[model samples]
Target: MSDGVRLNKRVAEDVPCSRSEAEAYILGGWVSVDGVVVEEPGARVGHDRRIALLPGATAMPIAPVTIVVHKPAGVEVSAALIDPAQQEGKQRFLKHHLHKLELVAPLEKSASGLVVFTQDYRVLRKFREDAPEQEIIVEVAGTISEGGLQQLNQGMKVSWQNETRLRFATKIATPGLIDRLCRDVGLRVLAQKRIRIGRLPMSSLPPARWRYLTPVERF
Candidate 1:
């Protein structure tokens, strides 16, 4: 076996930084050996191997992630539903992204739609404090008469957007409130799919896949 130096020691010497800074850079995913990024500070490296540090890489705390998931009916929302392969966002999948995650905008297991999982406490707080005031848009399949539609709109807004479906918008809805409201107004519920929450739209996100809530996106 060839005797190789510790990667952090080599990095500290080559980068001309302190041992601790070198380790920090390594841990921050800034350093690569032979063009392959190696995060472990204690990894052994040969003297002849080329090492490069990516430009603008920093040693800093990893930012918490907020993920928007489109849950399918009857499926549970959990970290098990988050697969690195299914990530459609620009952020690289890190195992830490799944840690300390809290669910927000919870829906019944029987209702499918936009749900959120966040590691940031600020996001959690916003969803919790603003839920009662947040508007939810759901696509529902039902048949109703003009009188029934008018009755449905007495407390909640129901729109016959098309001949094929009905759109329901409400700010005072709980998990099963919409269904209960529809039944109360002589409407038969065929299916329900939540399409939007607050100002966030499900957009093109399909069931079970997720993407990062970008810094620019709110709610």
Candidate 2:
């Protein structure tokens, strides 16, 4: 009997990689069970299949489940256990009740909008590594006492202490200027949501709901 339990799940369990990484392996034809390539992460297999992790592959999830939440302000996007009351207190902030699932990324308490969750580690890794330029839409309700907005228009330097995706922002006086706006607004960002990741936009998905990212959408 082949010992395999869905390519992605097996990969997630065996290695430190995420589910999305396994999917990439499978899709790239990198995963093999008993020397035969398997493309489906949900495909059932024995507990002891001689599974091999090949380089660069993609595995297809049954539903390709991915979630996009319009995270409101106040709650934290972390895996650490917290009080139920705390979670409940931020109910309005949550796009959905996500206490059951593990948060793959850390969303700050002050930041809000477009938090993703999934069992797919590969996807997580891709986001972590590629850090593809994304479009973040933030709406500032209050006015800035200082010339933060002016300095932003002139361009400001921003950095993260930890090694993460590189990002820059600029002001958007244009209607379609997502990147420019983030760069130009240095005042206290009142509200924000990642409207688009790569080419995928969160405008269609319901708030606090999950959707499977199709293979094409993985990039």
Which has the greatest lDDT? 1
With candidate 2 superimposed using the best TM-score fit, by how many Å does residue 102's alpha carbon deviate from the native?
6.1
RMSD of 1: 4.9
- Name model 1 segments beyond 4 Å from true: 1-57, 132-147
RMSD of each: 4.9, 14.1
lDDT of each: 0.77, 0.50
What is the lDDT, from 0 to 100, of the residue 190 in candidate 1?
Answer: 60
Single out the weakest 10-residue window by summed lDDT for candidate 1: 132-141
lDDT of 1: 0.77
Quote the lDDT for 122 in model 1.
88
lDDT of 1 by residue, 105-181 (tens): 77777777887889998888886676633344445555665588788777767777666467777666567777787
Put down candidate 2 lDDT per residue, 59-99, tens digits, no spaces. 44333234445555575665332323333222222222232
Superposed Cα deviation of residue 158, candidate 2 (Å): 12
